[model samples]
Target: MSEPHAGSCRCGLISAEASRAPFWTSYCHCRDCRKQTGAPVMAFVGFRDEDLTWHGEPRSWRAGGVERRFCGYCGSQIGYSDDRLPGEIYLALGFMDEPERYPPALHAFEARRLPFLHIADDLPRYSGFSVER
Candidate 1:
């Protein structure tokens, strides 16, 4: 059976479920990503817009040419969507119930990676957007 995947915000007030698997997953090291996640890097999984469902209202704002969504109650980031990539929704890996199941296959915005941060894995690295690089 295809076990569905689930996730929630820090306060558990914002929850979501994915009926199908994601299309791609990656670790992003861009300055915007770091600032949004408040981490050295941000991990995300991309799913078709139709495959995911949300349980609560999320506040959103435009940043770096994309719409960033987060839980209004807990200030937890929920996901992001780019106008250029229609039909796709990217979600935070940390919020996933089983984040390990969606290991990042590549690192995006490698050029922006912090000088002090280093990812030990040898996964493919892209200087910019993985899909474009």
Candidate 2:
């Protein structure tokens, strides 16, 4: 197996590894995503759950069917999973060492994007989850 790509929380108290390349990458503008990240949008990279491994005990909670996990020490959002997208573990793009390696392919929940924020990219925009679009 090739060496896995690694990521850590802001304070380095939580870390994870992905043994395989991401299945999908996107920027999410859903209200839920914005609220959790404290940003106008959140970038995410998804991997099959089996390809991911966690190094620290991250705190987690389920909300609106999504299980959100984060570093307990620094409060950096680490990752999340939704039953609606089975078998996928989505990590915060900013946590990765080479986040630019996975630029967002599209914008999800464009309907909820903040009015003040503008994305210059010409990537496809979906009103909801890409699967639902």
Candidate 3:
């Protein structure tokens, strides 16, 4: 059985619950992600959109064809949507209440990764999404 996972925004105004395991988890090093997260890379876990239930509507913005959603009150990034990947939602891994439970299995956009950011030697690395590799 999959473990139950729950999390909320910094201000607790927005919350979500997922009853199943994540479909996939990855670290994204794309320039856009670096800028959005203000970190070396952004970690994310993919889930079926229908499996997630939010407490309220979050503010959203479009970037590179993906709709990024965040808490309206705290501005904490929550997830993102892409029409090309119907039925799939990508949640920011850091937002999880226990983020350590979901370590990224792969690294994407390695070409754009920062020079000083060094990932562990184990996880698979790709220039872009694995689908494109």
Candidate 4:
């Protein structure tokens, strides 16, 4: 079998792997995402929940209608899931072992994007979630 896409928490206390290709990749410009990831734009890779597996004790919490997971020891955000979008998992791109393999297909919450960060790409942009979601 091919090697799965994998990654770990900053301190390596938590790890995750995906056996299947991701469903979607996106850049989220929402303030909630920025606050959670401490970045102007947060890239995310989405996959079917069943295709992904997690290791170690990652703490989870709900905020803004999404359940976010993080390493309790290092406080590094690992990923998030939303009940509204069942059977799907979204991992933080920066935490991915091979992020270059996943490129942002669209921009989410574009209206909330920071002024200083300008991306010239012509990827679809939406004020909220893209129509695909």
Question: By lDDT, who's the top model here?
Answer: 1
Q: What does candidate 1's lDDT look like per residue over 1-133, in tens digits?
A: 1898888999999888989999999999998889999999999999988998888888999965799999888899888999889889899998888999999999999999999997899999988999641
State TM-scores per candidate.
Answer: 0.94, 0.93, 0.92, 0.93
Q: Tell me the lDDT of model 3 at 71.
A: 91
Worst 10 residues of 4 by lDDT: 124-133
**Candidate RMSDs in order:** 1.4, 1.6, 1.7, 1.4
lDDT of 1 at 18: 89
Using lDDT as the measure, what is the rank order of every candidate, best first? 1, 4, 2, 3
Worst 10 residues of 2 by lDDT: 1-10
Stretches of candidate 4 off by over 4 Å are 131-133
> Across residues 1-133, which tens digit of lDDT does each residue of candidate 2 receive?
5756778999988888888888899999998889888989999998898988878899998977889998888898987989888888889998887787889999999999999999898999998988541
Q: Which of candidates 3 and 4 is the stronger one according to TM-score?
A: 4
Candidate 3 error regions (>4 Å): 131-133
lDDT of each: 0.90, 0.88, 0.83, 0.89
Sort the candidates on TM-score, descending order: 1, 4, 2, 3
Candidates 1 and 4 compared by lDDT, better number: 1
| Candidate 1 global TM-score | 0.94
